[model samples]
Every structure is written in C-alpha cells, then in structure tokens.
Target chain A: MTYEVYVNVLPLKGLLDPQGKTVHQGLNKIGLSQVADVRVGKRIVMHIDANSEEEAKSIAEDACKKVLVNPVMEGYEIEVAQNA
Target chain B: MTYEVYVNVLPLKGLLDPQGKTVHQGLNKIGLSQVADVRVGKRIVMHIDANSEEEAKSIAEDACKKVLVNPVMEGYEIEVAQNA
Candidate 1:
C-alpha cells in the first residue's frame, strides 16, 4: 500500500525563531499590514511505500523520532490517509 | 480576490537539523529500513484576503521575508493560486 504523510516541524514554544521574526519584519517593510503573527516551520509531504496503514504510521513515527523531529527542540505531527 | 497559498519551510542546506536526524534514527528503530532520508520542515496553507493574485503574492512574499522565515537559517516557498 501507499500512504501520504504530512509532517510539520516547528521549534518548541519559547524558542527564538530568528527566521520567523525576520519574516515578520519583512512583511512590515513590504506594507503587508494584514499578515498577523507569522511563524515559520517545515512542512513535508511524502509518499511512502508500505504494507498497511498501521505499518506506515509506525514507520513514519519512527522516522519522526529519529530523523524528522528533535523531541527536545521541535515537535511533529504525521497523518496517514485511510482507505487510499 | 481571495487566494490559496501553499508554503514550504525548510532548513537551509549545510545547516544541521537535529530534528531531522532524530526522526531518521526513529525510523530505523521502528523497522522502517526502506526509508532513505528524513528532512523535517513546515507546511502552511492559508487563504489570503487580497484584491488580486499579484497582490497576494506580494503580501505572502513580504510575510515570508519578515515573519514566516528567517533569512539566515531557513528558506520558504510560497505559491498562490489563481482562478479561485
């Protein structure tokens, strides 16, 4: 089976996101007044080859722990499509 | 006009992503040996309130430069849809 994985990687709350801050400042410079609270993180969409959804989830979760996310500094969420 | 924006946030090349490394390790531990590489990032989807696609892109780009991303550590890609 094949699965689609949506991954969100973000720095933990309270951590300094220099990138987000810079982007926020840029918005003001460009006169984009409506943009409020710009926070930046990574979004990854992947197609996985697996035997089942459960197996795929387990693999993805493991990948999240080992390579996709740093539990200490970042958090991640992974969702696998059902009946796909 | 309203626009649909798809944003991808990622760590710059050559930067160490501890989170991505951890997720890679987790994948191996979970018996997902087929997984090759795990790079962590953020994905943001937003509906923009704008008068035109060009305006929306400008706004989104400004946001990316100021708040959505750190120019030093991260890179962002924003795609605004038309005919929506």
Candidate 2:
C-alpha cells in the first residue's frame, strides 16, 4: 500500500520568524494593515510505500525527526491517508 | 472578530520543485528509500481582524493574489477559522 503524508513544519511559539516578519511588513506596506500577524512555515508532501497506514506514518515521523525538522526551532504535524 | 487563516502555496503540478528534490535525495541517502516522491511548499498563517469569517477569507485571498502567490508557477489554498 502507498500512503500520502503531509507534514507541516512550523516555527515554535515564542521563536522569532524573520521571513514571517518580512512578509508582515510587506503586507502592511501594501495597505493590508488588517493582517495583524503572520507566521511562515514549510509544508512537505510525501508518498511512501508501506504495508499499512500506521507503518507509513511511522516512517514519515522518523524521517521528520532525523532529517526534515529542526527540533530546536520547529515542530511538525503529520497526516496520513491511503493513496487511491 | 479575529480569524486565523492558513494559506498554502505550492508549485503547480508538473513544475519541478528543486527544494523537494534536494530533500528527497537527502532522505534516500539517509536510508529512507521507501519514500517515493516529495514536494515542498510554503504555509502562511495569518491573524486577521474582520467582521465575519467570509470577510476574513476574502481578505486572505486578496493578499495571496496581490503579493503571496505567483499565478503562473504556483497555486494556493486558503483555510479560514474563527479565532477564540
């Protein structure tokens, strides 16, 4: 079976996000002042071959922990669905 | 009312994502070879002040069109939720 995994890696709360700040400033400059705050993150979509959804999710989590996510700066959430 | 909006900006299908490719190769090098494919995109989370959920979503879409997304090369999806 193949599972489609979506992983969102976001900056930890209380950490400064320079890219988000830059975008916020740009939005304000462009007259979108109603945008109070912005946070920018990464979305990673992956296709994995595994026997079951649980196995696919586990593989994704391991990949995130080992290579995709920066534990000191970011946190990740994963969602898995069986690919049709 | 305040609304939390999530905007996902992704490369259009058939477009090459260099970052995704790099990460894919890294995963393979790390022995997660079961990963078949990967696509990387951007997630933008915003806090907006608006009169209603519909209004908030409209504002976010407008922002995406004006500054956040490149229509020719990328596509975007917006999700809105009322902030408590």
Best by TM-score: 2
Model 2 has a DockQ score of 0.88
- How many Å off is the CA of B76 in candidate 1? 9.1
Range of the 10 consecutive residues with the lowest summed lDDT in candidate 2 chain A: A75-84
- Residue-level lDDT of model 2, residues A8-74, one tens digit each, is 9999989999999999999999999989999999988899999888999999999999999999999
Best by lDDT: 2
lDDT of 1 by residue, A1-84 (tens): 667666777777788777766665666577776555445667765556788888777877766776667788887777777633
TM-score, one value per model: 0.58, 0.96
Q: For each prediction, how big is the interface RMSD?
A: 3.6, 0.7
The clash count for each model shown is: 38, 0
What's candidate 1's i-RMS value?
3.6
What is every candidate's alpha-carbon RMSD to the true fold? 6.0, 1.0
| Chain A alone, TM-score per model | 0.85, 0.95
DockQ of 1: 0.28
- Tens-place lDDT per residue, model 2, B1-84, is 789999989899899999999999999999999899999999899999999898899989989999899999899999997683
Deviation in Å, model 2, residue A16 alpha carbon: 0.6
